[model samples]
Target: MGIRGKDRQIDNIEFNVNDISRSKTFYGSIFGWSFVDYGPTYIEFSDGRMTGGFTTGEPVRTGGPLVILYADDLDCTQLRLKAAGATISREVFSFPGGHRFHFIYPDGYELAVWSAS
Candidate 1:
């Protein structure tokens, strides 16, 4: 079989954060994102073709909200994400069978990702 670019979905994204190290650990714990250390400037969490990164920079807390992704395990997810660098605008304790967290992009845009399982 031949390889094609379109065959793969968006696996990773890098959003600037106030502190790279903090965010890296936070997102990793929240979503169980595996972080690959990339020197002193950056780090990535990749699940095969799917990946995301955290870098040092100020994030935006404006604009439209972010797309939330549901998870099978939310309690741990929240704890992990919080450790990374996400400020829990809303804690994940009373949201049905799932929970979520929020973060700000460098563009002042607010977005959230969650899981319900």
Candidate 2:
């Protein structure tokens, strides 16, 4: 189905880790989360309720983890974030399923907005 705007779905979350294998094993053993390995540096998981990913080989940001949200209109979402005084940390980039951009909240938390559009 095509995406529709303004819903503001909190679709998934992602974390940057120093070791994908270690994080996968730890979380899997503790929470029984299942994982899918995209490569040596990337692994996705489902915690039975929600889906998220662990990333390695990249600079993990300092403000804890990344929270990702879904938007139907990527451009409008970004504009709204900018208008709200959020800092654009990363410009829009395409991944396997969609495109996304990272922004920093006023309190210094980092988040991302993504869209299939």
* Predicted structure with the largest lDDT when compared to the true one: 2
Candidate 2, 20-75: lDDT as tens digits: 88888899999899998898778889998888999975687776778899888889
TM-score of 2: 0.89
Candidate 1 on 1-117: residue-level lDDT in tens?
A: 112232112223556656777876776678666777776656666755566656553353333213444444556656766686666665554543344566554444555555543
Which prediction has the highest TM-score against the true structure? 2
Clashing pairs in 2: none
Backbone clashes in candidate 2 total 0
After superposing candidate 2, which stretches have Cα over 4 Å from the reference?
Answer: 1-6
Runs of candidate 1 with Cα error greater than 4 angstroms are 1-4, 7-11, 47-49, 57-117
